[model samples]
Target: MVTDSQSGQGENNKTNENGSLPISRRGAMSRLVSLFLFIGFWTGIAYIASFYFLPFIQIKPGFIASALALVGILVAASVIFMVRVTPTGGSEARTLDFQTLIIVVFGTASLLAAGGITALSLKPPLLAGAILGILIIYVITLFRIIRFTFRSDREIEKIRSQYQDLIKIERAKTEFMTVTSHQLNTPLAEVRWGLESLLSAEGIEKENRDMISMILKGVNRIVETVADINKALSQKDKTATDYASELKTVQLAELILEIVNVLGGVAREKNVTLSFEGPEQEIFLGGNKDKLTSAIKNVIDNAIRYTPGGRVIISLRKEGASAIIRVQDTGIGILPEDTPLMFKKFFRGKNALLLQPDGSGLGLFTAREIIENAGGKIDFISTPERGTIFFITLPLKKTA
Candidate 1:
């Protein structure tokens, strides 16, 4: 039932799927093997010229030995061609440039001319002329390579331009998603507030109360969907930020308290204890406050969502020059296989899907982007049925 285009797209998507170590390793091995083969070919040519040509030359032993040695040096120079040819990975545009081809030709000519002139015992003028011609060809080849290097510089500039455009597009997409989430939240919040007010009225029937509860749950689902989309959009923009100037001294404890307050109601509804446990001392770190806050909130929100009735703890402390933020929860932990993919967009573990089917799976991905952009790292430890703990460490200063 599938067309060729559809099938090809499926194959391309499969090729791009994450964590395929075997394929990458095979590619590296193939490159190494190719390099060895090229080296072997040059070595064989050098051996032939030294063994066969020296006996034919009528020149003195010293001249014959010098010619043979020069042949070996010429063979070694052929290896430099590898620098000009980049691996195309089977792409159509992959090819050797004219300069690369010229380098190979000139190197081969140099070795051949040296061997042929010595073997033929040609006139001194003819031998000198031939050697001079080979030298001139090599000089021209060198000039060509220099010109190609300039071309490559332009290509690099073009690539940078494309990267900037991609950044702009990502920023636009994130801004749109943020606006959309805000718009959706306004209506959902209004409806939920209206329903809660009506539920408080006296003499409301049990049936009506159950209907109101279902409506509230539906509203919450919509809010969560919007949140997921916004999180993904935020992630796109997070990668584009200039981290060096963005990070500044910010209060750690206050940020954690603000995030906990925002998610407090959600925790209360799930009968989970959400609390902060760390030094009350002022902990300051060089970081973008808004991005850091969002990242920490996402971690806390995740903990609250997975933990049914257990405790979720948010801790902050300074370890030397780095700030360490830990979020620990007594919840259904992640599987070993899924731990590495936890921060990847749209990835969900088995237990996570079982607990929350409506999750869009972008929370941790966004959190990772935020932390990484602020020159920090995020890691987690989890065991099934025990709990999960996420650790975020950020440098005290942005190092150049």
Candidate 2:
């Protein structure tokens, strides 16, 4: 039985976080050198056995036994090293340790038993040639194994370092966006409130009222832009539970009606017929109200802007457990080549640019981000020069 003192010493030796004895670069190198020495010693013993003990056994029997043993060892070695090493949980180091054990145990045992028997059973002239061939083969095989092991470890370390750097860069970017969005939101909110107050005053002239209304519209757009930035920032590095505090039940039909009402003037100016269709029974889903409003508003506004004198229809209904919102528009449809990049930030199709050269190309990108974050999906199908249909699907709030 192992003594308690020996057991305690074994436990004390494992100082690494992974419950393994710590090994530095120098210590690993020392182990590698020791491995080479073991290989050399094994080769020497094989040479001695072949030279002195071959006569003791029949040549054919000795050759067959040695061949079988060497084959088994090579198969075992290959199997040991074939396991793919992942970068997680110090697996690379563990693989190295296991490989060392395999090489030392299997290499020594097989060669001591069979290495000389297989090669030395031949005539004297062939004996030297056979020995040299065996040595070359083993040396090359071990060198390749050592090279692959350390090179993979180095590559894994490089990838880990790059991943850490990318994380730092992303966090820094998110912080900058958070700060900029807040700074933009405050001033934009003040401007909107001041504009609304001016427009509401009784003594304001008709022309002045129109101008203030236009300015208010501009301010609202700025506020929406800032809110989009904030939403994008919040969605990064966050989970569903992180958003529980902000989500609330939203009535899909009412929201669609409200967006239609707000965009009515824009549709009229473009001579586009705008309408909303919904089921008599109200459908509700869970999401952030302001963000959802912005998302729907963007889709509808884009429809009106691009449709000109065509019809734009917004509809909402409940299908099983999902609330479906469809915005179908008779507008300049997306080009086939641009489909793959449709929802990428700042991506604009050739047809869309032709329709509105000044478009910021952020509307669809922001819409998808907000909807997806709220456990929803947004997709579209388009036929160039004919029309486009956008579909938004949100999970319906479960009824207890």
Candidate 3:
């Protein structure tokens, strides 16, 4: 039977398989520490040799200023050496991991050398004892560094393994969300179309019609939930590349008119009159074309969904340096309490929720994401029972 430590060594220690003694990483670190200890001890011996000679050497008038200039040059050289030794990962590299130890040891040695130059008249025996004390302190500091380095190496190994495991777990989660969302969406799409057909049919009792409407609403809600999951998972997959970089001149009026046409079915279903008025001159700007289109579409779409048998008027014009998009809707409007959370994800106002129970609560949130990503602003004005107006203001990206 093998002991636990031997079994762990058999699994993790590759050298154990070759019939040789396993050398732990700590052994090499100890050897490196011994070399440093010898260097520091030898430095104290040199300090003693310099004591008598330093007293005999005559002091020159410019010596202090020249010495200060030499120190400044050395400090500048150390900074340059550190920058050159920096790894490809840049400033965060571990090239200067032992900087504190180096600073302490170098400063102590400098103090000892300077003290020897000043304390030359002292007796040899007392001078030897003082040097011994300094060497003892230096040896202790080296030992402390060896212990810290050993522990830190172990911690780094542990963190590396944990980071790898975390990556695998996150990938598994993204795959699961993507697969399930796609599976649910297929059947939900069929159900949505079937409900729309049923709602359009004639010869149904008023009581039964309400029941069908409720069932259709519930189906729509499930579809929206599935869509939210897909969108959430895709956001995790999108990298910095998906964000806008290049710009193209875009006509805001043309885009708004196209969105109004696209949402026509929903407007007709709700008996909401939707219209768009363009500016005198074609409003041109530079932006991410696709993202801006989605932003404008979501805003107009929300206006149609919440309004009950009313009109929505969208107009575009310039306000000083910005192109203003004014969307006025005769909807349920928002309550004062819910006003602050207007653009938050999955946060529907009390009145909006009561109007369309199937609302995903992502419409305004997505709109904000798109507009802000393109460097624009969205604001709103509302009354409790009257109506609401949303304003989208974007700085005109000028063209030559």
Q: Which residue ranges in model 2 land beyond 4 Å of their true spot?
A: 1-75, 84-135, 138-142, 188-223, 244-248, 286-290, 357-360
Q: In order, what lDDT does every prediction score? A: 0.69, 0.68, 0.66
lDDT top scorer? 1
Model 1 lDDT on a 0 to 1 scale: 0.69
Flag regions of model 3 displaced more than 4 Å.
Answer: 1-106, 109-121, 124-157, 231-249, 260-280, 286-290, 299-400
Better of 1 and 3 by lDDT: 1
- Which candidate number has the best TM-score? 2
Ranking by TM-score: 2, 1, 3
Q: What TM-score does each of the candidates earn?
A: 0.60, 0.66, 0.55
List ranges where model 1 is wrong by over 4 Å. 1-83, 86-190, 239-248, 397-400
Superior candidate under TM-score, 2 versus 3: 2
Residue pairs that clash (backbone atoms under 3 angstroms), model 2: none
lDDT of 2 by residue, 190-301 (tens): 7888898898889989998998898887777678667656755665444456555688898888888989999998999889999999877989887778878988898888
Q: How much does each candidate deviate from the true structure in C-alpha RMSD?
A: 12.3, 12.9, 14.5
